[model samples]
Target: MDIDVFYGMCGENHKRLETIEHLFRDCEVSARIWAGLDLGIRVENAKSLNMTDWIIDWVRYLLSREGGVKRVIMFIAILWGLWIVRNKIKFEGLAMNSRVISGLLFESINEKVRTLSDQVDGENLKKCLKGGSGEHIEQKKSEIRDGHPLQMIGNQEQCNVIRVEVDAGWERTYAAAFRWVAYDGTGQECMRRQVRTRAESALQAEALGVRDVLLWAASGGFLHLDISSDCLQLINEIAGVDKEDHLIAGILEEMRGLSSYFHCLCFKFIPRHFNGVAHGLARQALKL
Candidate 1:
């Protein structure tokens, strides 16, 4: 079936591909899959018998088949996520390993379980979140920054805020921000940008920030992200309760193009009082 993104590829027959063409793309997915495949190989020490050659041959075979099995795996996982289906594989429970990411991705977790659902209490298990039924997570409003404490998601602080200061300089416009860890989760990068003044408005600035991050991460490969800003007005606008002015339409247009690569991304707001560090960075960028 052709997706909208297929037709949208600007005459680039992105949707329809013969076996050879499709396999070429799956080779890219294999690049990602190989990271996980390595562990499976290492566990068995499949290094004997010119293993690399055999692996390459196997991949060529899968490609010849147009990656039919891999696509089915991805489709099934997406379905599990949509239906919230819980099941098991190899005697492993389904809660910890959802169809989306688990079972396929490698992790720091040790002592593989027969039941699979067995996990460290503090980490992701059945239902993705490591808690009883994930009800606690849903009730808390501290997931992002506000006047109260912010809960850290991943490496992010619960309510960390980003302050982007724009400079309307005589020569050129630029921006920057103060960098700090509101939640600062592991395997994550945290920083801020304070741009100089733009022809666009502040709401446009917020949209640009979102767009820029999405574009960068999809191209650069980020698994998780939590971006918070003190621009409540702009943040709300990006969340779509308010309409954007004409100034930012073009920038937003660019951002919508970046969607497939990210796994989790959330934008948040912190009160201005808590945004002193970002505010300082913006002020500093203007002076430069």
Candidate 2:
């Protein structure tokens, strides 16, 4: 039998020969996605590790963690997203962004969280999905907010709840930063974070800021959140009052999925002047 030799090429970069490690971990695009996930998995340290052993070791390590099962699920989701993106680029000749995979990962993880039962692993998965810290908080039933401005929680009612204000700083260059400041019931600052990302527009930047705070607050076990943002359009999009722009539709959907994790969640539109603290923080983060 006569056969022709086949050459394997990297689907993402096109210039390099394809190997499991290069396609999944070492490719420039794949490396950025892994870094974005912030899972603490050091791809650089695994230079000498075979792909099989690397996967197995991470699985075992995640299984030993507090939310091992859920973390494992997320890890699998990342791998799945990476594979799909690679296929799209190879077969469909499509250009893909790292954030697209992140959106897919959130959607997949959210769907998986719902099917989990009431077993210990299921509960752990739920906690992990909700961004709950390893703290014990009795689960309570809550419904998604309908986004009625009238239904908005008043400042008086927020006396015992965390009032988290989120804002974004964006430049025409697409460099952006999201900042959130959390205040205790008494209106004293308790927590704050500044994160960097890229966005195409001001509205999209604002949406990303809200999503960032939601994930952080949930992870910190802040079950009841009153999240305020200065971008009224983004708030309206989240509350279903206005149609979300195509640029941020996926992020809005992900935010809605995260809403279920809280005992109560409220979205409030604050004037830019009132949101000065978060706005200033976000701008300052851009310089960092």
Candidate 3:
């Protein structure tokens, strides 16, 4: 049934049958390969020197004399071979190859993967990126409810301290496979908004990155997360612990209170050069 379900997704009957046969055949072949090696036989070259013909004959010689499932794969290649022959003879067509079948299967799942990519959370960071917070932050936004215009401007100051970059620079490639990855513990339903950016410093980019993640999380049941950044000066300014940097004091306070649902909130500082991948994302975030 599992094969039937996915097999139908392939669309071509001959392709479906071929892929199913190959999948089962490969699974069996791989499972028994080590045993063949231990027996000191070159299974791969069995096609040459008419070895498989004689081997099947020898296997038949054994089947009539003694037997097992090993006999099935060896002597009964005809079970699958027969169907392949019938489709060719009846429909005057060739069977589909494994590669083409895989392409169709993946193509069918690509859009769902994109939707899933948008819903995932918490940066499972790579070693090369720094400065930027998460690799794939929210990319688009939508209004989930009706609210007042006054609420529309709801204190950007009162919002949580989200460091964001302006563009979607080099970070998207790492995020390209995002459609398939899962968001941690959120059970798969996610709402993501696209981000817009201007060329800015890593700190500013990192700022935007944090903003997008939080903005997306706000829509779902997500409320708590300890955002890690490499900007120590910004965190101190945000917490009001570092007083004299008077520029964003109001901005800091507003973001600090943005979350009414979070159990706790935190912003941590990390090193710049060590934050390469995130930094790349931030740099890329600026381009988007």
Candidate 4:
């Protein structure tokens, strides 16, 4: 049973030797849980490759980039949550903690990518509300009621432009809920919010609901806001055209420093049927 006497010891000299890249990447609790998963690839720079060619060169550099399938399913859910916390610290002796194993590997990869983004947004909102015509699906539900879509931007006029619509509702017990809705410029609804905390993904609860709806529309002094979501990689990582180094990169750098307190912010990607009223108030704030 020589996988170093069936994974016996690796650090603090209890007799170091458990291989498979020393128990999943030079164990000291797997190098502090893969260096607390900032995931720009390390495992001691692929420790002279072996764990299946360092996970096939880190899933081929995250499938050649751009939110590559949610960063290769969050690097295979943090290497299957560090091999189930190294088999629950070697058969239940249990007591490891790289922040509770990277918060249960980002809450089980954000509740399996928010249940596969709600079954591909319920089949793309039933194929964009198929074949319309209940008065054209009530005029495309009054132009997405609030996620804005009537389309006009140069000189405003998508009624007059305000629309917010954010969403989030991850679970796996790290909990998470987030909502936002705003809608003015004729679609009506004016304001809305919802919270609930502790997020570890659903893209960090949609980047903390776009940094709390851009600090509540710049402290209610709102200006031409926009900010939609249905999480197109969190609107392509807040419009810098996608680049996220995991754990929602500090809530997308606090939503790009709250987009300099917007005088005219924007960010869109609607689809969950024009973000169905902020995804039904983020699944009614995760059922309260």
Candidate 5:
């Protein structure tokens, strides 16, 4: 069948060329879907412009992570889901909600994993969805493995430490915002701040947020601090677990330098939901 075809723009956003990279990773809808998955995988950090190379690179990276095989499977499933969503929009004029796509993917993966549980070493997959009853798994929100152990501080010395949560929101236009909320030892709110800035990538935005938060804590006379962030990669890089990412090396170095100002400061990783307050604040700052 021969048909007239002229448009080359993405079906989902109609903003960029309908290349494989844009369809699967760069599209607005695809971005939202990935963010909603709650996986620490950052599509914005993709280093390759070629689709095949991009997939291979991400698969290799995921295989080295904690839930190796399971992560790979989900990565593949997300690509497949994105394609399905693109086709639905392109052929049927139907715009699927990002949450609906996420829910469907989770349900499909759960059922398939269950059906094949006895056929393979599906233990990791099963564990990932343990509390799930054919619904989206809450565990995925915090699945990024902790990079390193927190620096030990005597319990006596931690009595007056303030805890803070920091997060960043980034856009494709390079506009970014950083936010941090601090709480006293008694869990009372002490400081909350948001700053607008620009970043080259999401990782850079996260690193900038951590650095700003550390500076705020030190300058505000909060000598001892327990800093938390939902960006596991940033936390790991700061702890020297994953230092290969050269993109944010400068910010990380500044963060390390700032650490000396605090008598005791530790960076911790928390789930996205746990960092909701700072996350929302950062998103709000992006509008300013």
Candidate 6:
């Protein structure tokens, strides 16, 4: 049988031939999970390349990083999870969604992280797991100026800047919701907003949040701003270093256009622990 016919059409888009490229890159289910994992700029930049070249670039990139071993393990877990889900759907007629696959990948990675935390450098591995440490918690407290608990941690350069934290919750079968909260350098809540929208993937949902928040801030005349998200891939794409040639490309382009309106704007990636409030709001919005 032809490879395309054997693998079958992509579950996310039935019209496309289910080649490896389409399954891993173009399919909505895989695209969202990959985006959520945030492998780094190199992985994002390699998206347009063939699978062999992409894998080579990704492995080289991982091998050169400080906590590369942990990243490689997580990458393997994600791929394995994707494969398992794909096989289940193909062989057993199991219906899997992005949310389910993402959850499985995350859980598998977390379990691996926990098992390796003792053997590896705890601090670095914890950071790799996207979990903040006690030092981070204390730093977050010290950043608060007005005595109001913002539950946000900003970069050192973010002092006196409007730090906006954005997060999205996506369910393949249901609508996605995005929530953003703005905090002053001193960690005082300045503004908060939530919106419900339809998105085919979590990556698109995140890109939408970044685009909308940038437009909202620019319109409000917030010149000095720092946009942060738990989604590192989103930030990397916004910075123009990581190019994602997928469904979220248009949203990223809009963000690039809106970014020029600010006097001084920076995109940063925060660990999920530092972005608890905004993430919580996003999860809450999903239920509405």
Candidate 2: which stretches are off by over 4 Å? 1-159
Query: Model 2: which ten-residue window has the lowest total lDDT?
Result: 1-10
| CA lDDT, candidate 1, residue 101 | 35
Candidate 1: minimum summed lDDT over ten consecutive residues — where?
A: 1-10
Per-model TM-score versus the true fold? 0.36, 0.52, 0.31, 0.24, 0.47, 0.45
Residue range 1-288, candidate 1, lDDT tens digits = 121222111113334432322222222332244345422222123323232223333433342355434432332233233222111221343333233334433221211221222323322222221123443334323333344223222332443323222211112242422223223344333544444434334455455555555544555455455555666655555445457557665544343323323333455676667666655655565566
lDDT of 4 by residue, 86-178 (tens): 666677765554566556656765676666555544333233223212232222111223543332222333435687888889988878888
lDDT (0-100) at residue 35 of candidate 6? 73
Superposition error at 157 for model 4 (Å):
10
lDDT of 3: 0.36
Q: Which candidate leads the pack in lDDT?
A: 2
**Per-residue error (Å), model 6, residue 42:** 41
Compared with the true structure, what per-residue lDDT tens digits does model 3 show for residues 82-162? 333334433554344454433433343344445434553323211111222322112111222222110111123343333
Candidates 2 and 4 compared by lDDT, better number: 2
Compared with the true structure, what per-residue lDDT tens digits does model 2 show for residues 1-288?
111121122333445446677666766666766776756776867766546446756765786788777677767766766666555556666546556645664565455544442233755544544434433232322224434331232233434678899999889999888899999888899999887777899898898888878777878888778888888788777656677699997666556556666766678788789899999999999888
Clashing pairs in 5: none
What tens-digit string does per-residue lDDT give for candidate 5 at 1-288?
A: 111241222333464336666767766666666776645666676633445445655665676678777676777667766655555556766435556556655665555555444454545434332321322221112213454434422232636988889999999999988999999989999989887777899889888788778767767877778888888788777655676478787566456545555556667788889899999999899988
- Which candidate tops TM-score? 2
